[model samples]
Target chain A: MTERFERELMRGSLDLMVLSVLADGANYGYLIQKRVRDAGGDMIKLQAGTLYPLLHRLEADGVIKSKWDHSTGRKRKWYELTPAGRRRIRDQALQWDKYAACIQRILTPALAALPAK
Target chain B: MTERFERELMRGSLDLMVLSVLADGANYGYLIQKRVRDAGGDMIKLQAGTLYPLLHRLEADGVIKSKWDHSTGRKRKWYELTPAGRRRIRDQALQWDKYAACIQRILTPALAALPAK
Candidate 1:
């Protein structure tokens, strides 16, 4: 099996991934972690340390909002996209697509030019 | 035009892009920078600061080797890939494809789920 993409490759797009998941609905940290994991199909695993900092950063950046909920009988913090975050999702997603396409252009010919494996 | 991807997005894939350019033939720093810029269609501009350090690192990694040529009378440093560098290109390219696919899976549906702009 091909090795997973190195962490650096995933770092740039991670905010987009989490924002995308929230587009489906509001979620707490654990669910966000699971969704990213499941969406990447074994390529992504958002650790708590990574996820919380990212979530906090996004909140601090005004892209997301969080609130405490005790309605579930235990206090849990839920996160949802703000208007800025929705726009961020749109913006970052577009940028990510373009970047991926550029990579494809370089990679395809480079691979073709290689002596066949 | 959409804004160029932020530096972080480009940073992760920088090595792959340079290696791809080198795969075409032995090249000096300026040409590698030019090829990446042209191929990215204005999305990439591999500044000398970024390019040289990366070249040195790749050289240190033993994936690429460089030689000084005075035949041009400019004492240019030319670089070419080693066998390991070629192998790195293949492995990185495949991983990038899978990772891009994963992003697509999450992004497409997430975009769909958004309220119409």
Candidate 2:
């Protein structure tokens, strides 16, 4: 796997990615991981170990709240975004956009100077 | 402190904030902590306990490489961004912008609908 993809996936920014997914509605940990993998295509795959810690962190921060559910005849934590969490999702999304644009501007010249494919 | 500021300062995303400061040049941990506080203009102050782990993680990820320097007769770990580190910094800055923008767009309406302050 390319370093870019690995760096992005491993950097633990997955909290925002997971929050984006949960923004739609509630989801269990396994399903959230699956959704990130599916959404990111083959380029990014989130591991369970990373996902759970992030979920707990988000919950601890009160950005996202969770409750135990027995939907599958086994207990699982179902997470959903709270109003605060929703606001955060929006704020973080905006921050990411501006950040991406600045980086793109910086990279454009470098990319242009690269040898042709 | 407002939840917005606290939330931003916490959640351990201090990594990026630190990287942004170090982008100028190599700096020791204590100086970095001081710089972030000074740069943030009292809005954000990075604690040493939180700062060290983030520095270590960044070093571990190879986004930043560090060396111990003896200055003022005391040893300190000084960190500088690597080429790969620079690239990741740029990428992350971009991602944060995009995330922030989308959030701002969503919040505009909500802010507008709020009663006048």
Candidate 3:
């Protein structure tokens, strides 16, 4: 896929990706976006507009918490997963595994079924 | 977890969950919410306030397309994944698997490491 297309697709799945990244340590918005892009290779990148809204929403939902940090010369909002957030990422990961397996089952056709009955 | 807490956690992961749910077939908002709750086994439920915004955002992003259906007595918005969305869910699923594996690595400790060298 083109980088643009990949970016858009990535936007749809940003929350889980963000939580997973923050699972490592606290990070500010730009750094998180950069990490996702770097980690995703050339396939995905996140726009600030999309990323900020998701970060704000996650904070509002209490999955992740943010605080202003002034250690970096200029103040920046840094985010980290709350205890609730950590558990949430774990639960969502489990759910995603089950859901993906179910979808694969539906999508996969038995080889025997390929021939006319 | 309480149903309420599960619902909130589910909110954080709703987009991927929604696309996975819709992969089965097109469905209206209420039915989709019901299916998620039923499939999730009391672990997840979607609220309209949250669901509507997500649906609208997905529509805006061209991941899922929606239409108003009037056949069910009341007008309800129904959604289905676009081809782009299908590809997106697939990519995101693959990325999530890798991300999960990495996190698990960070979390797991070598048994020998428990004792100081």
Candidate 4:
């Protein structure tokens, strides 16, 4: 809204989105970026600078595991969720729902109470 | 959720929530705290330490204005929206809706594709 996407608002959510991308199947960095962009439309864009560090952190946290594949002509590091990551997606998704509902509870009435334009 | 409130998620939102509180009418620190807490149910709690600084920043930004009132036998600083604040509420509320919807767009299908519990 402020000429830039609200990156601060997106901070806590990046992990969950990345995990969700892997939920369907393994993906390298670029494809995960594409899935989020496609799903989010203009609202989300995962720049490579932001995405790689996040992937490293998730892998370091043991939620994801990676393996390099050279069977195809091009080499790629593909990531998949660990069992723990599956549990996290389930947990974080529930938490995201609760947080969204909390904001709505305050926001809906606040919008209604606003003065006419 | 974590044992603690997701303060990271609350970071960018505190400004909007404080402005929304002032949308109804002027309110002093304690009343604003009560209103946000009640509206957010168990999900939000605005401690004085966090609330006061945010109020001062909003005042500095010129989106909100404050007055010291002594009519009720005790001095209290009451805050209300400025004309700019009204515009901010409208704009921020719309942005918030867009952001929420974006998350839902990605999250709903992600949830559906997850393995059954």
Candidate 5:
């Protein structure tokens, strides 16, 4: 699939996905991107344009908090989910699961009805 | 999950899912909604506010076409996938598969890393 298409699919759920990663522990921007890529099997990567704006929005909305960490001898903005963010992630994850299951149900039968290749 | 949340998750994929359902056979709005709900295990339902606009938009885009069917002694707008809609469904289904696989990969590891409940 084209990167654009994958990105589009990722658009709506990006916030929840990011929060999910952060739920494990706090992470810096680059590391967050790396984790997502590693988990996506290298097929999905976040673009700076999409990532930064979302981070900013999440921070502004009080869903996430950021602080500069210089413990590694380099300054990086580290992000973690807030209480609200954690709640949001839970709700979003549950919602995603239900949504996916519903869509799968709708598609499976229709797909089965297709003529065999 | 709230209907709103499910709808949000459905936003990006609504068009493609609808096309996929239509790809199976021509259907009217209520039936289309029924098919989706039945397949979604009744957990996911489409609102008229969302569904009608999407249908209009797809029709305008020439991805789908609608005609009035009076066979049941009632006038119902039946929608069928156009050739473009069919092709779009193929592309979208492939994209959804790849995107889902990628997200699953990322989420699985992060989720596994979380402390046991």
Candidate 6:
């Protein structure tokens, strides 16, 4: 990725991406990181430093809820989307679609102006 | 668009979007804003307050150049992508494609996991 695009991509959308992982089900931090990394084919890495703070902010905002899980013989904090978070992810996904479509339209006006094939 | 998505979208991408407008040809500030607005179908608004500073930054970064136009009996500043700007846009567009594709994979792992139809 270009340096500018990489910098801007991280600055903008990390939170929503993390929330998306949690949308599937409750997940611990390590797993959450892995899930996002694997899902993006490692193109987008969510470091612990970035992930934890965002998770905290989302929890504090009541978008997600977390609880300790000792089922694996070790303490882990598992997180899941709250009702608000589910709603938030749904809304964010829609907005992303709209925004992306708009950008695509702007970027390819010549193509957009063409009659549908 | 959701507020978070809008805020993040502007934070991350206004530069490239502007660069894209200039990528087509040199244009004055008003026309730059108009092209972007019209391109996005008004979903993405680039207020003058946000656009001029970004244009100046790109200029300072040497990605774009500007000069006064007086052929119409009024002074106007026209901006165009420098050679560096063209290369930058090309690189940025490729990065955006990769990053967006990565995000799509992460966002819809379920669909991605499905076998080819």
The candidate that achieves the highest lDDT relative to the unseen native structure: 1
Looking at model 4, the pairs that clash are: none
The better-scoring model by DockQ among 2 and 4 is 4
For each candidate, the DockQ is 0.67, 0.08, 0.09, 0.58, 0.45, 0.38
Instruction: List ranges where model 1 is wrong by over 4 Å.
Output: A1-5, B1-5
Weakest 10 consecutive residues, lDDT, candidate 5 chain A? A1-10
Between prediction 3 and prediction 4, the one with superior DockQ is 4
Q: Give the alpha carbon lDDT tens digit for every residue of A3-117 in model 5.
A: 5456556766777778878988998788887777677664567777778888998899898999998888788999998878767766676667767776676666656654543
Each model's TM-score for chain A is 0.93, 0.88, 0.80, 0.94, 0.90, 0.83
Runs in model 5 lying further than 4 Å from the true structure: A1-7, A41-45, A60-63, A70-74, A83-91, B1-4, B41-43, B70-74
What does candidate 6's lDDT look like per residue over A1-117, in tens digits?
Answer: 355567677665677788888767788899899988887664576789988888899999899999998888888999987778877766666677777777776566532332343
Pick the DockQ winner.
1
lDDT minimum window of 10 residues, candidate 2 chain A: A108-117
Put the candidates in DockQ order, highest first.
Answer: 1, 4, 5, 6, 3, 2
Instruction: Please give the lDDT score for candidate 1.
Output: 0.87
Worst lDDT window (10 residues) for model 6 chain B? B108-117
| Per-residue C-alpha lDDT of model 3 across residues A1-117, encoded as one tens digit per residue | 334334443432457678877877889999999987776554555679888998999999898999998887888999998878777766665655554454334233321122231
Off by over 4 Å in 6: A70-74, A109-117, B70-74, B110-117
Query: Alpha carbon lDDT of residue B27, candidate 1?
Result: 95
Candidate 6: the clashing residue pairs are none
Q: Which consecutive 10 residues in model 3 chain B have the weakest lDDT in total?
A: B108-117
lDDT of 4 by residue, A2-61 (tens): 533266667677788889889888999988999988877766767999999989999998
Q: What ranking emerges by TM-score with the best candidate at the front? A: 1, 4, 6, 5, 2, 3
